[model samples]
Target: MAYHRRYSRPGTNRTPTCDKISEILGSADKLAGEYSFGGRADTLPPTPGLFVNGVGMILLPLVSEHAKKLIAKCRQSRDRPNMDMGKSWLQSDQVEMKNPSWQAGMEKLMKNIARGTGYMDIHFTACLTN
Candidate 1:
């Protein structure tokens, strides 16, 4: 007579329990909301599994929205220092400091310096120049 085992193979029962499924769905929804607003409250509802991977789904849309807001804020902060420096440069009659190309170049140079790969000749020129 052949023996029948009560336990099945690992792949035979790949489905998760209903409670586990609910927990996973909840966690995903929470992460989506937190990512959307930089750790803010989540307002979106739990996504149905069938439509979860569709266009404008949980991850992409939320991340995109968050990125847009963060980028805008960064731009504003970046411009503020330039504006202040521009005013000072104007007072000193050195209007070149207000040039857009110069500012862009300076920003790039500063980023390079931050990465420790910038030119040594480019010394720190100001106390507060972003």
Candidate 2:
């Protein structure tokens, strides 16, 4: 299973950055909303045998949507200083930072995208499995 999320500080971080998250969330929400997951929201104790690959393939559209959003969010704070957030957004993670100009929050956003893409690819493949 794969899940992806994006974050944006509309005013504190940067306009471009927040705009990117909005763009990605828009695409992902659209795809996720339109694509049926083949299970009800309250479907508990999922039947193990209900492994129809076709059902999983439904999330591919959303994966791409997520990646796009991730990249956009990562690139957003490339020009802002860490002080923009009034606190150090820096993190201990290496990939947590993308470009020099990217704020700490943006770095984390990039990492999220990288991680999300890997999951998306794996799930997408699982969906294609026959």
Best by TM-score: 2
Against the hidden reference, what TM-scores do the models get? 0.19, 0.20
Worst 10 residues of 1 by lDDT: 48-57
Misplaced by over 4 Å in model 2 are 1-13, 33-36, 39-130
Model 2 lDDT tens row, 13-115: 5577766766776676434432322323222222222211212211223467544443343322334545444332222221222224334434444444445
- Candidate 1 has a TM-score of 0.19
Per-residue lDDT value at 28 in model 2: 65
What's model 1's lDDT at 125? 38
